[model samples]
Target: MRIRLTDVAKGRRDEALPPTSLAYASGEARLALAETEQRPTVLGLIASGRMAPDVGTVTIDGRADAATLRRAVALVDAPDVCDPAPNVTVAGMVAEELMFAGRPSNPVSARRWLEAEGFGAIARTPVADVSPRERVALLLGLTALRPGVEGMVLVSPDRHGGHPAEWWELAESFADRGFAMLVVAGEAAAIVLEGRAPRADAAAGTGTAAEELDDLVAGSGGETPAALDSDLVDDSEAEPATATAGDVAADPAARDGSAPASAAEPAPEPAPAPTTDPAPARSGEHDPIPESADPDPTPEPDDRDEPEGDR
Candidate 1:
């Protein structure tokens, strides 16, 4: 079975996803570049026939049949879509996926399944806490179990933060087992994989494989995918660049359209000149006069005992 996406794209021009083309046949794992949380999901949705692209076509075996494509391909771990809840235990998630595959979904069965899959230790662990490699392996394994799924489109496994090789090797293993695998990842993953591809080709003595990988990367674009990498940057991880008080003060262009403060407003009047010089200090005595003398004063009579009414 072969799945080909020809110039497939979603959303308006230069938004969401740009026109992308790639193909993966059975027993082959292909990597496609799709930066940002939304683009991976969008590409996975279109590639798996869950969404209709705004342009181009996705054909399975040269036939543009959405229902067939949907049945044959599984869209795995798309954020806000098929991804298991973060708070769900690994066992609980496995059981749910087992149920979807029409298998036993009891806790006991789930635990036993985990044990068989070599993940029994993490049975009680939250899905969110699962290691990236383990999570990707588990999800892909579960999706493969569902009847009629011959291909899998894994969306943004790189977002889980692991060396790309770990999951790529796992996907290649699945492909070796006659499954069509497509990984939708960011430029970082693409770069890592592209660097490794030549080495892999040299080791395997297959020049064609390296050439194909190069073509895939080139088709995505150089240095960045068609989608802006800047948009893909996590807002929490990197603060947006802003003009600080110093920056604004130093950079005239950083200021708003309003005129400069000096130009826009009047200067203040000079502080009133001191009315009188400060009184000189007397040794061992507090100054008798105030610093600024009162304009008029009511003089006090000498401290003499004068008669209240001198007759």
Candidate 2:
């Protein structure tokens, strides 16, 4: 998928570039390379047909009927494969996608294809009931099943599949079936890159574009994807308890809004608590020990028998 990033990130100059060119092309490639937690989602429309630079044309076979160029490459357009209306069954939707892509036509053959990709069970289910990943996974499997596809392009495949082995096995299985692969990941996760093509570099420059947009949005004004990297500042690894206010106060450049106070600033102290000992109830008016100015006074014992003897 080719995503056009906006102004939101500006501080990703410290990121690393990849070793391939196609890595830079499939759209999400650059984001996969960026080490920073900060990033944007401006990946431009996917041009999956074949990277034709001179023709000024980028065609994506992953799109829906080729009306718009903004479709994702991998399972990008796969999630929306089924119609929202009850016009078609979930299995029927899968079959239609296969047929449109020129896969097998008859339902029996299509079901067999679905069975191989672990999709036979949910085939008749409504498209609305299926989870997002399930839909995407079906498409991922379909790409694997479809014969003569030659090479396949995947956009942000990592979002749907977490472990590298889960998708890698599929790619290996597909390659054994004679299909090429292109995978788009959120990060430059090499383990997932196992079976993909004459690999291309994850566009390191894309991170720069994202960073510049991020910084611009953060500095002046304009909408952009939230800075993923800056938000990472809160992690225990980046922040310490002993981090005095001075460290935060020193940098005006870093503070987009109001700067924090310096160490010289007075800190509010904690209030003291009342003691466990209880106080006496209110007396007549003023109750005090005669001839006593001290706060703590000793009480004298009553002598009723001595008073009676004196009388």
Query: Highest lDDT among the candidates is held by which one?
Result: 1
Models 1 onward score TM values of 0.63, 0.36
Per-residue alpha-carbon lDDT of candidate 1 for residues 173-227, written as tens digits (9 for 90 to 100): 9989999888888888888888543221122223254344444444454344444
Q: Alpha-carbon error at 160 in model 2, in Å?
A: 2.9
The TM-score of predicted model 1 comes to 0.63
Could you give candidate 2's per-residue lDDT for residues 1-311 as a string of tens digits?
23221121222341322222232232222223233222111121222432222212232321122333322233333223322344456677777767756777678877787787677888788765665566555665665444434445545445444565555455545446444444445544554454543234433333464554444454434554356445545564665445346755776743556555556568998665456853553543234345656645555644532444332
Local distance difference test values of all predictions, in order:
0.79, 0.44
Q: What's the distance in Å from true for residue 85, model 2?
A: 10
- What does candidate 2 score on TM? 0.36
Off by over 4 Å in 2: 1-20, 23-47, 50-89, 103-109, 116-118, 126-137, 144-148, 188-199, 202-311
- Local lDDT at 52 for model 2: 21
Worst 10 residues of 1 by lDDT: 198-207
Residue 97 lDDT (model 1): 96
